[model samples]
Target chain A: MKGLVRTAVLLGVSTLVALDTYSAEPNARDIMEKNFFVSKVKSLKTDSTMVLINDKGQQRERKNTTLLKLQANGIDSKLLVKFSTPADIKGTGFLQVEHSDGEDDLWIYLPALKKSRRLVANNKKDSFVGTDFSYGDISLPKVDQYQHKRQRNEQIDGQDCYVIESIPINETVKTNSGYSKKITWARTDNFLETKVEYYDVSGRLLKTQRITQHRQVEPQPARWVALHREMTNHQTGHQTVLNFDKIEPGVAAPDEVFTTRYVERE
Target chain B: MRLRAAISFAALMGVSGAGQADDSRVPESPAFEGVQAFLQTRRVSGALRADYFHAAKRPDQGSDLLGVTAQIKTLPELGERIDGKLEARITNPALNRDGASQSRLLEGFVTLHLAQADLRIGKQIVAWGRADGINPTDNLTPRDYTVLLPFEDDQRFGTTAIKLDTYLSPQHTLTVFISPFFKPAMISLPTAGRTLRETTPARTLANSELGLKLDKIGEGLDGSISYFHGFSLLPDLRLLGSNPVEPILESHYDRINVLGADFARNFGRFAVRGEAAYVDTRDTAGDDPGIKNPYLFWIIGIDRTFFEEMNVNVQFFQRRVRRYHAPEGIADLQARAVALLNALIDGQRDRISNGISFRVSNKWFNNTLEAEVFAVLNLTRRDRFIRPLLTYAFTDHWKGTVGAEVYGGAADTQFGSLKPRRGVFAELRYGF
Candidate 1:
């Protein structure tokens, strides 16, 4: 009986030691997975403004309303964006529905033509409505598509963060993203991403993204949302600043708003 | 007296409904609540435009003119399931008219939203088909070809009709349309020593136009199948009589049927769209030289983006006339005139006609500037057309556009006949 008790105590001690080791420093993949899904709320509605500034101090402003909803699977999502200001592009809207099979569907409506057209869904590296943010930059990257490694911890804006380096797993992912590598800075407490640096094929810095402001949207189990973001092209000296005038998380959004018919309406 | 009574009744109902508001809401007088509802549920928007066009060569064929236009649109919501739109336009130096003013209602309609369907009535514009500019299934509305607009779609006008769209499933819809008025396409026909007269079809129950369509809009594909039974928007030329010098031609509408299908699909980075329509005209046997013959028209296009920002679209179109007979060798002068007119209007100069269109567009300067070049080549008839346009946004509310249209080929070809109408144009618009 004494031997049996001694064995159980040893086993308990080893298990606690193992758990402590894991809690001390989580794996990079787990951290990245949390960072990618940090904003995947049940539903989100926001009125956003995007300002583009050139090297010569010229600026342009665009206003839009964005609606986002997570599908039942919790991985796929639907996004709708409608432009309201900037006369030349007023009444233009885009609808994107993500599928589990990686075949997303996109549709664009042009008020001048009074028609909605289906668009090919593979232009991930292209600009998002001519903004400095590429389509790939704004979308959440799949965790399994990259090789992640936990780098040395760092301090950003006087807050502790986990620095992670991610490299594309294959040539297709690399080509589609137009990025060879990405480095992310996520807060240690919430796993909310605060900064990212994109590298081109030749390992040159292409763009830098920074989240300047964020807010806790839910209280029971904390959920955070980025209120202000800025993307700057290091190669072109151009920058785009995005601000959310109003953001409502966990809001109720009807499924009808994601349809092409809704996008075609004035 | 009836209209005034109806207005008063509506106002009374509005005030009565205002009294039933939620108690938690801010308190206000009933009349004030009614006025607030009216103002809060309505949206108003408009644009002012200044345009100029210059014909450098063959000025007699075109014109040099300057014009200004004001477009105003309003949307008013009456209830949870009811809304209406009223769009008005006023222009100086009206289209095809010099030193004239014109005012018209571009679109005015009321829509009723039901559980599974939507019903719209009054004048409205409905665009059909999945193809780019060359749509074989877009025949429900007529166009003004003489409008001095840089974009081809700018010439479209609303048609008075009743339309119903019923949702059959989450991704499928069925549409039905009916119109009692027959509006014809306005084309400038050359009259060199010829007297022409036009007559519209009588507005009768039997003469009403009808259209039906079934559309699927999701699950990786967008497509539709449609059928239309209506009078042809383009009038047919009939030779009434001929004197020694002038030939008298009467233009009349012909009943016709159209069966169409269109689809759009994405394959990797390329989007493919295609449309086909079979038009069955009154000249089924191809025996009548004064009426257009039955024909099949199809178009297939593919678009892709290169270099992240430059988009290129390529399309191939073909038209095939059934039981076609050459109109070149008609012995009688009146018969020849009628045959030529029909052939010209239907683009049936060749039994099998084919063409290609290519467009390249790009944006720069943070999307403040856009440029596009569009070209069409008629391979069978050797006619060609090209348009180049550049648009720049000066500010949030202002924009400027400059473009030029040029046509080339022998006079007998479709686009070639309009060579003299080639010109350069510019426009500035401000929106509020």
Candidate 2:
């Protein structure tokens, strides 16, 4: 009788322990989903300056205006980037429509050509206007497309963070993307990504991105915006610094702003 | 020259006067400060360029050209519908021993914006067609081939017209253009062997040109269909009188109607584009040797990028003449020679002519240095033209470029005939 009672007690404790472990540590996918929604907004407009530094430390600066808006009926978003400086590239524009279900659509307008041309959507690993940021880096990744795992809990810059390892779920995404895997450090308090390390196809560190500045934009949903970012490529010994001069959240952007006609307009 | 100088000075003074007027009229309130700042941001910007060319065989055709251009634009206040733009350019050729310098207004237009439509009226460049390098539907604006510039964009000349664009939806638009002035393309003639004269149509409403286009923009594809009722920019050559050594010809424009369509789409890492046009030269019977026969022109191209930076484009083009025939009637030996020359040069009587064009470009050093190569091969004529160029941005507003144009093939072919004109050129430009 005593052996039977001990077996019941042991089973009860084991069940409770399993439930506790599951509740205390959330899975990687859920954590990433939380991080993705932490700062999502209806619309945003930003004036930014991009500084590119070569291996020799020579620098070039480019200014741009960016607008982003979420679709009303779907999880997709639209983006427009217009270059405003460096006279040779002035009046250049890029428009993108990021779909939730599949690949994104992109178009580029060149002032010299005086026309807007549709660009292949699969070139996500290409540089964005000579900057270190690739097209994929500038766009938000679809959370479900990546397989994620919680690596550990650590502290970076004195803030507690959840270190997560993310790998592409399929060969298609892995082959097209510049990085084989990415390890992200997200703050526990706000779920803001503070740092990320990118690995190449050979599993070598290719780049490191750090967010140095953040500002709270909304109070109700607790939205935070990164005001400054720096990306350094390990293999090329090149760096790109992005400084946001102005950021406006919840701005009203009409659908026309995302159209190719608007991109072609002078 | 004096009148143009006066007009330029007056425009400068007008800008200063407008600035002063805005300063006095704007109030000190914070709300008005935004308006004042926006108005002050509207200013004239321009560029100054110097170009030099050297020909290996023809020193007389080489030239040193200097030019300056200025442009100004202003956006209307909120709730207002009127906006305006003004652009002007002046150029001087130092070595050509032709005429004096020239100045002209490039574009001066006023736009009226409505709820779903906009109308613009003045001298403007209406760029049509979607194909790169070669445009079969780009007939609204006339080009000046006599210009020493190598870029086709620089050779375009605007015409006085009224244009209207109506937004049918977010992805569709309808555009209409009406131009009262008929400006024919100006091609340089050989000064030694030919005496050339031109007869242009009289300025009248009957000579006006009309064009319409329907454009569609979508995620999967983008394209346009257009129709133009206008005169041919290239004139038809007619023999007036001739000697055994020299011939005198009258070049005159002819009425034409064109229907064109173009489309572009992207598939993963590749992009495809196609353009086609059918031209009706009014004389459909192919009986007149002086006038070109009706023809169908088409181009299909693809683009791809490799190695992260290199972009390559290839295109196949063809032209098919309807009711084709060879020239037979000739009254004089010189006239017969001229007719044969025209037939050979125009390639309009050929049953079917095909060609291929390819271009590759790459950039380095944060896009400061760019190199490009472009080639066009005439398969039917066994001729080819190649151009290679390198450009460097020295500063934020300064640029330098060096390039060479090369031609090769049979002596009677188009590119082969211009073999003597092949040369190297350099240019420097500063913008503000």
Candidate 3:
């Protein structure tokens, strides 16, 4: 009994220290409540083509595309990612991420050989179309899906930031994920999450996601400078870099675009 | 096998022209992974199970045993093609009021895959024939002579066999099998693998033999069909099955020919299935030996999904069976072989058993409350019986079924003894 108490105390103190160290703080939620604005947001759509460079400097390029539409009057958006190029995948719909938590549901669709499938949660760590970027890292995170606790203050690329530790309260929360906990760094000024590291159910580090080149002081008349995300799978040594190409504002698409008819309008 | 062979044939034929239709047509479980990717899961697990059986007649007597099984379902996930189920079962010897409990290592085997073909080594279930009632070609495993009938229970035996299964296409498969003579337990053995003086197991094969089979069929929602022929070693136990030192009589009943076919197709809400098989057994029958019994079986049922949310289902089933005459020479093989069987039967030389069973079930109330009724009627000369049963599935994995059977007919028929067979069974199962 005494040993149990001593162990519990040690765990509690260590957890507090770890949370303080990785907090990305200045507090991501507080920043979320502040700076970031989708004032004139439109349906964001893009064809993110990727090129892989081997150690020997050889390149294998793939035509991967992602589509997202902002929810009118809200910062949330519904997203779908598809890989369609290189002749190998002419019309393969790789994935579709939906937001359906309450009436608000979330989903990801995959079309490889003519059939499409729903990519569900417990899949946060699952590869995205054979890529390293987990489904959760690429898709939008639920507002406070986890209790965000600001741990420490840090600076990345000259931006003031708040490092926060997010822990899922109940097992029922669906992030299409299996993460026990995650440490995220968010810029306090812009409220944009800069970096995140995910841990497995066993509390072992599984992967890392780093967001770069925020629409910071855009020279172009774009609402967001197109956020860049790089996701790496530590176990497989595979990584995928995503670029949001076409960014528009003030266009909250109605239910029409989420339909199968428009998704495959071709 | 038929489906696999068809798949290959279709692939070759289609690629020569266009693309082949695939299993994508069959709604797959979100959990099912494709062949190439499926080969990557390396899973190992252990399980423990207990079975307790109580016979109504034996009030104070019952059978109970606890068993443990360890399975390695995956080989080195590296080769991208190691296949087959390999598991070992160990049951501890225990006291039983009804029967003796014995221990044995159940099964162990490995399967190797090459392209679309599969090769299996070690003891395995060499299941054969599509005939529902009679599977004459399924002989790789030894016959459990004590069962209601030979090969009646799929769990009884796993013989050392080598089989090759090749998929002709996504819809067709073909398999050939051979079981080099493996020893079968001589029931008369005073001890495991032992007799009065010398140990004698009823099995003999001076040479190895091969069997060929071909199947062309399938009806997923409905059923499947096939044609098969195999040389199975039938123990000639005229000697050991008799009194004292029958001196291990062992011989072979070679060159058995079987022509069989079976299928079931669902026309709307009604599902119909049937099997017709003829076995030209190559046993030299003597006067007292039994004849080769061929049979035909047919079943038709209608399952209408009246409600989805409630999962309410109602169905009706009907079955018809026809028995055939045994070969003239069957009555000739070592006389005792026939006498031993005749002693177990109280019927006339010419016998027939025909029956039909029907059941109806309704599932509702959060899938918790369920009601079911079943009835069976025996329709044959010198035989008559009736059985009624009920069942309820209280939960997803727990259910109870109880039934009572009444017999009325002369002692010469299955209705003999008027034993009034009845029992209640409760089972619990959980899946991961």
Top-scoring candidate (DockQ): 1
Query: TM-scores for all candidates?
Result: 0.88, 0.86, 0.42
lDDT, candidate 1, A127-178, per-residue tens: 8887889887777768888899999789888778899999999987787788
lDDT per residue for candidate 1 within B215-237, as digits (tens), equals 99877899999999998888888
What lDDT score belongs to each candidate, Candidate 1 first?
A: 0.81, 0.76, 0.43
TM-score of 3: 0.42
* Candidate 3: stretches off by over 4 Å: A1-266, B1-42, B45-47, B56-78, B92-101, B128-156, B182-211, B217-255, B283-353, B357-378, B381-432
Candidate whose TM-score is highest: 1
Task: List the TM values for chain B, per candidate.
Answer: 0.87, 0.84, 0.57
Off by over 4 Å in 1: A1-24, A218-222, B1-42, B56-62, B93-98, B243-245
lDDT of 3 by residue, B1-432 (tens): 334433433343333231111122234355643532343334332222222222222222322211112212222333556644544444321222224433433345666767566777777655543322233335445544322110123134566767776656533556666666463532221122323233333344534445555544322222234444444334322334544534333333334455555444434323344444444444434232333333233333333322221112222222221242332325545454333333223122244444554455554322234455444445554354443434333221223333444556654443443343333222121111
Off by over 4 Å in 2: A1-24, A218-223, B1-40, B56-60, B63-80, B95-100, B243-245, B327-332, B340-349
All DockQ scores: 0.34, 0.32, 0.01
Query: Which candidate leads in lDDT?
Result: 1
Query: TM-score for chain A of every candidate model?
Result: 0.90, 0.89, 0.71
